[model samples]
Target chain A: MIQVVVNFTERTYNGFMKVKQKLEILADAAKYDASCASSGTEQRNSRNGKGIGSTTGAGICHSYAPDGRCISLLKILLTNFCLFDCVYCVNRVSSNVPRARFSIEEVVQLTLAFYRRNYIEGLFLSSGIIQSPDYTMEQVVEVARILREEHDFRGYIHLKTIPDASPDLLARAGRYADRLSINIELPTAAGLSALAPEKDAGAIRISMAGLRERIDASKDKTASGKCPPRFSPGGQSTQMIVGADASDDRTILTTSADLYGQYRLRRVYYSAFSPIPDASPMLPLQSPPLIREHRLYQADWLMRFYGFEAHEIITSEHGMLALDMDPKTAWAIQNRAMFPVDLNRASKSTLLRVPGLGVRNVQRILTARRVRAVRLDDLVRMHAPVSRMLPFIQLPDYHPGATLDAASLPARLREVPTVPQQLGLFM
Target chain B: MHTVYLEHETDMEGWRYAARQLIRLEVAPQEVSWCVKSAREPGIQGDIFAMPDSRSGSDCSSQEWAISNHAGREVVGISQYHGKTDVTSSTIFPEQLAPSTHADHLMVPRQFIELARSVILHQAPERFYLLYRVLWRLQRERGLMRLAGDADVARLHAMTKSVRRDMHKMKAFVRFREAIVAGQPRYLAWFEPEHHIMAAIAPFFIGRFATMDWTIMSPNMGMNWDGDVLQFLPGGKLEALPAEDDSEVLWLSYYRHIFNPARLKLKAMQKEMPKKYWHNLPEAELIDSMIAEAGTRTQAMLQRAPELPRRKIIGYKRGPQRPDITGGNE
Candidate 1:
């Protein structure tokens, strides 16, 4: 059994007493969750009906990190203490980080307070397994349950999944949470066991597969106008801790490729390893390069928004992404034979592969292309970055293939490396 | 927009296309806050009319599209990105374009004002959304019979058109200086609005350059700097700011200093400042050459360009400004 510090036996179990400390510990623990993006929801507060808030997303969302991504949710963890010492966790039961816990009431209070203050649009809560999976699961579920049924907090709530917890508890959790996530520690089952001994990879998969089935079933019921029961209205998401284990970039990306195919997840966050205290001998001494995390995000964008597949990205030594250039650019440079694709005629999938074009840009091209044959001027009119995109794309008005030779393509694409972290002050 | 909402999802494609056209027509209402998300499949889950697609008005389809194949799906002139009610609607166009009004019900007079302009002038699709909205409310609220008449609508339309022209000039002509006079960074830019309404937009520039001692030089209509003085251009040549001076070299240097090559989104940048504007400013030549050689110069965005050798003393001349007579006061 795990222990609570400052002996709560003397103070009693009423959660409100520890409400302040709960916010501190829980918020820190939740920061590592990568699935807080608020890009795609429209649900609002039923000011008249049983709810106190809304879920319409807004602003730079604290994301758009150096790599231009948004940190969307009020991302935080429930408690960092744990009985099962995951090697990569800074707050593992074996590690020396300060720890705290909130009773269900305390968590509910913090979320309501924060929501009322307009600090976050929603709450994303995860926890370190304390005492038992069942025990931690019970606490996390109650917070969501009370928020929905009692407080009528209708805002987005993304709850972390306890893989081995019971179906009964998990099902109740799905009822209130906008989304649920289970960290697939690394790409493969063996990697999971090696880094996190107590965690069961098979159990994790079973839970994910079960969540998928429930999400699909509920979606069907809702579409048919049955309202059978709202189950994960925002759907399921997962995260993989990159570089914690000896997994190569190809292996990690391949794992993501498989998960997307299998689970129908809304997203998969790639959290690069943060070195833990009293770290295991098997783990590396340092955190992976922040660039690796960035490259992975770019690669992830390729798969989701840009349309690149696993085999297209997997390379030999680099295996994943080049630290300096994005995966798409690196791929383009390697496949010089495919240069100067005619933007007017290229398929939507092909247009997306060009470095400067985003999903929205591709859609615009499709819309504009149908109206008239697109010219280089049209690309500029559409606000497509002709600078980066010029060499790769062949427009009706201009062509760079004749001028840009292979020997100098690298120089043409180079820029002084500006770390994204330094740009935070302006925003 | 309301009819489209009531129509089945499969039959609303035409409605969607029309809405995009209407949205692009408006000059302002900056950005409409659409609920790009829906809780339902096909990703649209809310009541269609209430989904913040366009302005709140009488369902035009009831009168106009009554003959369409589907009775539903005629969402015209409704604010889509905001919400069902005026209280929550995010007008798709900027505030300068789509001014907020009572969101829930139609103010018919504004609609008439808009309808009048469209019929009278055959307004382009881009400007029609705003005029339509203005005229519709005028008709509803002020009474259709009491319209300021055909002359009034024409005058308002012309006013709106001038505002549009001036905004483009403000974006292009507004310049800033980097030279420090005394302890402060002195800045200035020149403009020549055809309408001569520099005073109306001075606040925007003031808010943006809150810390600088700046002057905005307009040809024939002067705008001077210095706290105690507000001097107008004592009428000069109509061709304003047409010459090359050394200051542009320093301006481009400051611009290059802040350009983060890591986050270069050329389309976004060019969308804000197009290439055509590059000719008048000295920096334009350098930027045009750089962008032209984009394929090869992606690596060294800054160093690749020759830098202005650091000057030992501050430059305070550009055909000369009224120098501060502060020595006499001291």
Candidate 2:
């Protein structure tokens, strides 16, 4: 009797320990992909008391990892075992890293447990290809199926779709997930062929096009004027691994522009390549400057919001963005002829081009000018950077004068102190 | 000078009632003072029924207020206070004290009401006075809210922005720990919010975690939901909740592993998840070590020579194969 009791306790301990170990390995493997947004989905709630989750159309960052990334979801892989030998991936078959595979039930339980404790908004499930593309996609979809159907989860779910999966499987994935994404892997086709030989650039594009079509179809009303079944209501997004290849800033931006234009993607995430445990020799030894990734994001935002085209953003002689100043400042310096815009009368698009005036401040200026003349005090009240906008905008109380034509303008603008590259070890 | 004492800090109804009455009396902004009745010193009686003497004529020059309020009858304008009669008897002033003998119109821009709703949640004691001053000016300055350059409007916007941020942070940072109460599972959390937003954010929590039995306790208030109704009670001590749970170990592991050591941006993390929230977060304990070891870890990865390929890389091969029990995908 004593022996049986001890065995029962030991079995339960091992079961719990196994989950902890698997969670550590799988989450570490999946950290390379950088799409953690949980917002912009259909608003849902558990107010009916049938489920235990809700989404407010605005993503909430439940926690921030030490890497400064948003920890909004339980981002993990079903398994860290990959058959494909992608040089940039840590889970390539050749890599000698510890591997783990979570059972479908384990992923469901983990998601519920974390969500119940307010630890995450929902689950972000991705996995390495096992058996075949269909099988792996099936397993990933099954996790969502259980979460949505059996548990009646109403929270956000972002599923990473495999390009090689069938359209039927992808459709089912979209049905269960709030958002779907497929990693573009690399910027250029040649770079992808060289590093990740197994992943087909053509196939990825086709999958994205398919997703776009379905997403569009989902928004249309049927003949009966009834809404069609939802398909990735939050829309599809993709990620490109920056610094993995010799792609320049211009090339990266151009590729992103094409992705946005072609697929109508909600977002194109740029992930700075960091070192892995068993990295390939084919890849660069050092990670690219983190600022490079930051600049790309800034430039990407300009395209999406400020109406700046890709070619116009990278007009500098070098293909790389200037490390000293932001992409907007660089663009403004390059196009000095467009400066000294009138804050009281400039169009919304022109005002958006001003270096320091954000979308919100621009809107405020537009509204304030309607009621009364906008003055320098108005900009100050709006928290607009006075010195930064002085050379770019004209108001009734303040004018750029020769500041826009001054040769020292760029240097003066760049004179702002740069953020330290890294923090001290002990401090 | 007339003083108006509200019942609590977040008494928007009381503030609205008193402001309307003051505006009806044509009381200058400076002549009226706002105070919370409970916050007064001991033995000091709250002037809850203090009403300024009524002016002889309405002189309600605000055309927008008249057009919107005086659609059918002149007496209906005073009846608008009937809905808010439960707030205080002062709101239901005698008809003889009506600002206008014909039509008593006291209305500001709809935008002002929304701004005051958020600004009133701020912890600043001067918030009520600022709001009242803005309301008094809005009656005259129809486009006052649009003039962002005005000091009162700027202060209102700033206070509203702070309250909204506090509410958002409360939503983002509240961490629940699982516990058993009366042999039933319940999730409990303790947070210290910067403003009087406990009631404002309760609906969000209730809507999200409706099916579960949970309670979010702060220093001043507690919100409890038990699958059916949400109840607001007085705050409780942190000791009443569990310090840790079994799931925390898993959460900490996920936090540690998900962090990319090569790219440490402590500033970015701290900016979003400030030090004030670190104590309540279970994963914050790992941040220091993660930062300390990041440089060494990245350096080691950079210095370590790449291992030779174990086998000649094979092209994509598709087949059905059982997953390796111990490790690899094959």
Candidate 3:
């Protein structure tokens, strides 16, 4: 059995005990979660003098962490205590990490103070499973209720929903939260069974289906023409830990595609499994597959916005994405016949599939071409990465020549070593 | 050679009046130059040289005739020629022009107006001239604004983009520090913007931080709000704000702890949160140290052997028990 030494030098602040210590513990526990997005919420403001904060439609990142992660919301767990001993999790009951819990009032106060100082858009509250699922869920709901009803805080609140919690509690959570998420934890059911044995895959899906029903019902008007109560207008999102098990890139993306289609999830965050202190013997001791995780995110973006199917992106023999090159470039190289898309005449969909033409630049080409023919100079002025696109696109003044059919095309299309490799050794 | 001096820096009304008069008089764009009466040189009033004879009320045709007759000459107007400039008399071809010329003939598209809104907030001295130039050409070529490839339209778009970027940075970079005035909490932020965009971007701040009393101070102007009322103050300096505050300590703590040393994408980080903003942000001070120590920290994590898995300290009795596996816990 793991024995935790309670080593917190108990500090006091205005008769409140361990406030700073609890913040440290809880914030550390919450860091493992990858969902830091505060965007895509219902736009609101406290213009009426009734509330204390506002939420923009597209959320703002108040700060960027050294990891290049956005610090948009005050992401913290209610407590680090847990009943499940999930091996990948830092706060599993088996771990010897320090434990602390924030009283409902402390979370509310911290959220308000951080918001007042313009440090964050709003709160992103999650918790480890503790007590009974219902009891633990009730405590989480109370925090949101207090923030919403008691203080009229009209800020973005993202609550992590317990899959096993009752429908009433889930509905109550949806009412107060702008976005709600239930982490699928691992990609496959077998992975979940092996790593986080306590979590049920079927239960998670059932809960998602129920939440989707409520979300859809709330979006429409009733028969009497009365508006339904707002329910997670920012919609639901989920996270899947990447490189945690034998699940390959194809499997991970397939799971994400399924989640998006079934639950209509706003996002599926791919968290690279990072090494933790008090690590499990079963888990790999190597460095996290950060590059693989990044590739999966790029592939996910293709599936969501670029009309790429999960199978189309992972057409590699090993069912893995190329870590050295981006998925789009890899795809374009694999399908050499689809090269040299005419920038002037290609459809929006075809332009989107081009290696380096981003959605913004493609739209720019469409708009600019309406008045005059798009030329090389126009694309350069638009700041499109012309070198990356030049191999795959044809303009009035530019053509790929024999470059598209060349045997050395893949190597040519590869990202040039702009930064030296020694620095990458450390990263 | 007609230098039409506007009243103030962002005097769109003055620009509108001068443009209408000059366009009606059939004055070519190259013949006119737009000037704003500098704050130091407050010699005249009523949009200064706009209607040279100082017609204040609605009509400007009498002064328009004066401008046409005195072309290529300095026309100085004060508050002296109020109500004297007739609207109908200044046109180069008075009867041939449609009756709705003033109200409609010179009407630029809505896109031009929106573009002009951002363009006027630019600090470029030629912004007014460029806008009027486009406006003049727009009368003959109705589809001119649609051509982004055109140099004049492209310049207008570039100005709009710069102003838009400035506004976006103002929104992103303004970091409020907590202060107390009259025993109630107030927030103050200092930002350095590249354009005359304080008035243009103040509404976003007002709407976002509506309940709190806040002030967003910039070099050119300052915006203040006290829960209910939003107002503007004159320009301020960086010294106007305190260097540090209490809330920043916690904010910095959060920034430091949230950063994961293992994934250091410095180029990407610097792309969004550039080094130019480093001096203002409290968390930016830790960035250098974090990047420096990341190698050692990640190395330690990588080289360290996996610790033995800790046995469960607490258990949920109702949940599944351990299945018959080497390490599986149910």
Candidate 4:
């Protein structure tokens, strides 16, 4: 009797600790993925009181980690054990990190529990290749299926797709997921071969192309005017590890631009390569400047929203974005003839190119100019960066004059330090 | 002077009805004042029941008067009403000057209504007065609201923005703790919002957690949803909630492990999740330690010697048969 009681207690204790241990190891393994978006999904609510949760177009960041990333989803992996020997990956087969895997039920329960507590927008499920790519992909999709069908969960779901997974598994993943992503891993094919030898560059492109075609077909009407089944209604996105390869900003942006155009990708996340434990010799010992990642995001935004082409943003002989200034300001300085834009008469596109005018502020300026001439005071009220815009814009009450022609324009407008700041106590 | 009193801070219907009467009476914005009567305030405890007799000439029915009297304990003033036997006689228009019956016909832009709806929830004492002033000006200056450069319009926008942000934050930060109430599971949360946004944000929670029984408590208000209906109740002390849940251990573990020590932008994190909301958040307690140890942890990772490949190379090459690429399963 005593032995049976002891065994029972031990089993329960281990079972409880197993989940906690797996969560820590798996979540730690998955943290390197930078894509945490849970927005732009179809609007849903549990108003019928049948299920639990809602997604109202706009994503909510339930918490912000100390790393400054949005904890919008319960971003976790199915397992941290892998078969591939990716040099940069902490969970690569050869790496010495501790490994753990969660059963599908554990993931489902964790997602629903955390979601009910309003701790996350939804689940972002990714996994390392466990057996075959097909088996791993099936496990990831099964979690989403149970969340959607069994529990009637209507919240946002983002699944990190395995590019080498069978096409049928990819289709099922899209059906259950609001967004699906296949990480491009590196900017260039050479980078992939050097870093992640097992990952095929051609296979990644084929998967992306397949996703694009299905997404397009889902949007189209059939002969009877009936729409096809939903397939990643929020569309596809990808991530590329920055500074892991010798690719320049030009190459990165060029890849992103091509992905955006060719695959109709919703976003291309750029994660600056951060150092990991059990380091590999092939990887860099130090991380790229965090600001480099910030600059890349700004340049990516310029390409997406600000109507600047990738080549136009990075036009220097070194094929690099200015570390001292923003890509927009650098472009403005390089092509000074385009500036001194009239605030009152400038087109929306012209206003968007102004160094200090953001999309919303430009709209505000346009609205205010319709009633009366926009003055310096008006720009200040609109929260436009007056000093930054003084050289590039011509307000009705103010003009650039000699400021635009100053030889030290670049030096004067440089906001960030050219040299990277030392990683201090609190960066 | 027109002294119009509202029931509470977020009394939009009362404000609209009173403002429509004042606008019809041709009262200028400066001639009007707005005030809220809290239960703690002295005077006018008995006057609420007696005032309906003075407005006998007006079209306010006895039933409406009864409803307003029952709900008018927390009163807001449009003009100052001193303690007097006949306060309404001197407070509003004369008995002969009846409010126009066509008050609903008074028109403002749809934009003004949307702006006022958000602005009314602002904690500013003068929010109602500013809204009325804008409405009075809009009667003649039809394009007044469109001029974002105008000071009054800009202030309105700023207040609206603040209230909207407060609402959004309330939604983002209300962390629920599970508790057993009457042998059933119930989720409870505590939040302190900067604005009177409880009623405004109630629908969002209702839509999100419709099937779950949950309650969200603020300092002044509380919301409860029992699977089918949502009810507003008086707020309670934080002691009423569970101190912790077992699941929080897993959540904290996930929070701690997921944070990358290499990139610590405390400012960016603080910008979205400000320190004001730290005490209620269970994971917030880990932030200081996480940040304090970040630099050392990163240095360790960077300085750690690269390990040699230990495992044999498992070259699982793809076979000649490619995976089927046919698009749809159906």
Candidate number achieving the greatest TM-score relative to the actual structure: 4
lDDT of 2 at A370: 88
| lDDT digits (tens) for residues A179-292 of candidate 4 | 999999999988998899888888888899899988888888874489797899889999999998889999999999999999999999999999998878888766788888
**Model 2's CAPRI class?**
acceptable
Cα-based lDDT at residue B258, candidate 4: 93
True contacts kept of 4: 0.70
What are the per-residue Cα lDDT tens digits for candidate 3 across B1-330?
Answer: 455666556667667777776666556666665655443112223343343343232221112212222234333221112233553333221112223333556767888999998888787777877787788778777767776656678789899998988787667678888767789878888888878777777677777778778988876567788877767676688887865665566666667766777788887788778888888887898899989998888787667666554553655554443232112233
For model 2 the local lDDT of residue A96 reads: 81
lDDT pick, better of 2 and 3:
2
After TM-score superposition, what is the CA distance of residue A91 in candidate 4 from its true location, in Å?
1.1
lDDT of 4 by residue, B1-330 (tens): 455555556778767877776666556666565655431111123433233343323222122111111211223232323233453453542222344545365658888999999998888777877888788878777677777777778889899999989988888889999989999999999998988888789889989999999998877777789988777776568888887776776788889999999999999999999999999999999999999999999899888888776766577665343454555444
Docking class of 4: acceptable
TM-score of each: 0.55, 0.89, 0.86, 0.90
Name the better of 3 and 4 by DockQ: 4
Q: Retained native contacts per candidate, as fractions? A: 0.01, 0.71, 0.46, 0.70
Isolated chain B TM-score per model: 0.35, 0.77, 0.75, 0.80
Quantify how close model 4 is to the true structure by its C-alpha RMSD in Å: 6.9
Residue A277 Cα positional deviation in candidate 4, in Å, after optimal superposition: 0.8
Poorest 10 consecutive residues by lDDT, candidate 4 chain A: A1-10
- Encode model 2's per-residue lDDT on B114-152: one tens digit a residue: 999999888887787778778877777778889877777
Off by over 4 Å in 4: A1-12, A417-427, B38-99, B102-107, B321-324, B327-330
Full-model lDDT for every candidate? 0.56, 0.82, 0.77, 0.83
State how far residue A59 of model 3 sits from its true place (Å): 1.0
Off by over 4 Å in 2: A1-8, A222-224, A415-427, B39-104, B309-315, B318-330
